[model samples]
Target chain A: MTEDQIIAYVDGELGPIEALRFERAMEADAALAAAVGRHRALRDRVASHFAPIAAEPVPARLAAMVDPSSNVVAFPARPRRWFDAGGRYAAIAATLVAGLVLGQVLPRGPAAPIGERNGAIMAQGGLAAALDRDLAAAPENGAYRIGVSFVSRDRRYCRTFSGNAGAGLGCHGPEGWALVRFVAGSGSEEQGAYRQAGSASADVLEAAQAMMAGDPLDADAERRARDSGWRLR
Target chain B: MSSHRVAWDETGEIIRFILKAVDGTELRTSDVTEFERALLDLLPRLRRFARALALDAADADDLCQIALERALKAEAQWEKGSRLDSWMYRIMRNCWIDEVRARKRRSETFVAEEEGLAVGEADDRRIEARVELGHVDRAMAALPPEQREVIALILVEGLAYREAAELLDLPMGTITSRLVRGRQALLEMLGEAA
Candidate 1:
């Protein structure tokens, strides 16, 4: 067998038929088996040698770049017009200011599919039903999959969801469920699979770490929240 | 309608809380914030890839930082729905090539052999393991850049052979050949170390 075939076998990249044939060849050939063993040992050593870096706290300089406060300004371009001294005019001015801010902050473009309700971007269409009805701990096969549910630091309910678009963290706010953090596909994991906490991507995990007010809601608490329309009150 | 208006009152505090939580560093653009957040999670993997490519720890981190800066500046070029990690890896590989060319222009000596195996800190008990890892690292650093990258992508980073080929803009057969030779060299060097 070629060295490429041996490496392919080690990586499990070969098809079943090819793999079966390779296995037969391996059983008969000691040198080929020894090469496979060496390759496997080398791959393991490389992975383990680098594994510790993942556990290290990402350097503060790197973390600062993603810190929401450092990177996400709410509305920096609001026009600086002075308001008149009339009470009614002040109220009108405040309303206009709110509209301007919402226009900047609310999801726009293609993301508009997730409708805006009460100033929050609610998961619409399939995502809404999944959040409203689907239990994360007991997942069902669907286009959208819910991974974990927890209360946010602000006492709002938030859950991590993934679908064809990508993975994101959506939290229930006064208006509706808002998409707070989203990462385009990393091409690491497939959607619709029942991904456990351990399998969550770094972006999903960081969003959870930043927002999780407590441990993830247990099945009983989740059901209670669902029954009560996902409301904390 | 009235409830939506009241929600604005809470928005002020929510915005303030988020800003405060991030220590008052203002997010200039939504796209930048989103991109940075996504890229932040991939740093560890990127670092590991850099470690394999650049060999020296400081050079690896430098390569990572340069690639990140380039990715952020050229964020518009990134096609949505594609794998961000793969795109970043391509940028990193380009950066390494440019660095190599620049070093050649300057006629500076390339990385010292001993400098190539610096894989972060190790404890006293794992001395034997560290030595083994050191040998592997040294062997990896000795390969030509082309062969080293194929090994890095396919062997260390776990990209499929096809994916590695596409990332390197090479044919599948070339990737297989390079990988075959690279692995043989590595095995021979490792055997000597053993």
Candidate 2:
């Protein structure tokens, strides 16, 4: 066989037919036989070189893939479960320790927004538009009127409204209308702005209530309510 | 009709058992359970493959441990009905490559740590095994990483040619040629040793 054909055979690239042809040729040629022997030896050496990996125990860290419960403690971000009161305390202590480790041991910043910008008790923006266009037009119905308003003993003006949308009070202030407080009114609360209006007591509304007693705004009183800055709640 | 009914009954019972097992655990946790089971089942195979890739027993075990950790984390991404064994081989290959890279980066000189090779060791039998293993390990480590991975999977893990090709994401011809070259290289490397 030609040297090229022998080389192919040595590399195991020969198919059955080509291999047989090469085999027959090698049988009669000593040099060709030596080349084939060398190739075989190369193959054996290669196999033995990497034949040891199949007998070791997989490491525990990797084995934890099967059982996270045993290994999860190593990961600090994951929360642990507490099955009892003691467990709960332990979990809390663990959390505090972890927090200390993270260097966040105290309350770091203002947790809630502060409220002194503009007294929202009065009408403002779309609310001011609503009050201007809609408030007095339906006063006889009393459904959306501020329940009462007057200059308070503190000498600050305020007004409270029974929201047409539900049960709650909104007050008037220099910035426009700020809702003081709201209680969720049942039934059809979803239908209008009053839904959220009475849902939570706004700081403005509470301050307005603290300023004024009963007896709501007349046209002149309402105008004054919209000009003067309401004071601290 | 009665024979068909009996076969159906057996099938129903098998399905029932599978359902109960699956239902007993959260779907995510169930996969974890299956993965752990597969790891335990594949431990011996993993060791064999590691040994083939790493020359020393301790190094091989270390490789296995790293491979197992990677496989477990990646287990969630494994699709249902995929072959876990092949998934594992790929993980092992990557881990071995990483360790090789790390060692290279550290420029760490590794002396063959087989205690059995130490001169004048008291334990003859243990030393003989260690020396033999150490020779094989040093020879394997000299091969290029690509060739070594193919050899470990095909010759050591005993994966089929097509399976190894798929696992390595290589063409069948590439796998065959690599294996052939790898085997030749291994033999040449070992033959030079005593």
Candidate 3:
């Protein structure tokens, strides 16, 4: 087969008749078969390497840009009055107030001594040790439970965790584990409860999805990340 | 079938509204609301494509942002019956090309960073296989941008030759040639790494 025919066949670009003819020729010729196999393998390898990006959560900033409520203010201030006139702005305002109130009223479990350094959340004491050494595959059944670990779109090592304090996603950088977003009163009451509960709340899940650049690291990848001190470099 | 027709009609109405808005005519709030909702649904796919086209995660997201902004501004240019996703992809490709040209004008240096694929010194075969995939990611980064875009669209994003050609606004022969060259270059890179 010519080079174009080989590429066309590998890409499934050939019509039915042509593909059948190519297949018959491959059966009769070893070199042709080898060429086709190589191209197929190359395509599969490329696909496997990049396919994880599809399962990643869309970033929050991009989502906000497309959301009508947010984009109304983004356009021109004058146009937003239309939304306000329709009462939609009022409803949105009410929701925001309710959210803020709930945020203050929610009972977050015993607070961990987590601090901030260069804008990243720095874990101290138990939280620090857990983030530094804990593996998701082998849960400690302790104060914190590690969920999915992934590489963020910014190439940072990020993981989802839940504890008495709250549930959220955090990324490890030079300073420490930066808490990207945390939702209070959403974490499992206990390790056993978390397993039974299946997953974190929708809000926490959405936060995790927004930061994930690709698929959650598999068991081996997670172990490797932990072993390397959760460093992306 | 009837639901499909309904969706098509709704899309048609939205397009008309978009055209009117583009021409500085008054638009209904509902029209803008409907368009935003549809665009929101396409975010995940657009992000995936952006990730494939860009060199790193941050750059990928920046491209997505630019593409979304352009798509919003040029809403009226989108043909009613054409695939919105494909149209968005084209906008993204053009935006990337423009950035590339601008970077070239500035004489920015491109550096090939070491692949951060190192794992603990374990002899386990599974760990080794995963590391190999990491190498593939790095190898993909080393490809030239034009060839890389072909691999991204056809192999990574699973767009067909015809669809990718249409999206890139290139002829079928050019698409096929780039795909062939990209596959060869990638295989060679992987072989060298091994």
User: A1-233 in candidate 1: lDDT tens per residue?
Assistant: 98879988998889999999999999999999988898888777666666665555455445444443221122212212212222322223233233334232333444432554544445666676777788887786765678788998898888888765445667876555676654333212532222221132455667688879879999899889888888998
The residue ranges of model 1 lying beyond 4 angstroms of the native Cα positions read A63-233, B1-32, B108-133, B192-194
TM-score of each: 0.52, 0.41, 0.50
lDDT of 3 by residue, B38-132 (tens): 77667777777787766456778999999999988998888776778788888988898787566544332332242232211111222244453
Model 3 TM-score on a 0 to 1 scale: 0.50
Candidate No. with top TM-score? 1
Which residue segments of model 2 deviate by more than 4 Å?
A1-233, B1-32, B108-133, B171-184, B192-194
Ranking by TM-score: 1, 3, 2
Candidate 1 is graded, for docking, as: incorrect
Chain A TM-score of candidate 3 vs. true chain A: 0.48
Q: For residues A87-131, could you state the per-residue lDDT of candidate 3 as single tens digits? A: 422222222222222322222234543554443445656776777
Report the TM-score of chain B alone for all candidates.
0.71, 0.66, 0.67
Q: What lDDT does candidate 3 reach at residue A207?
A: 58
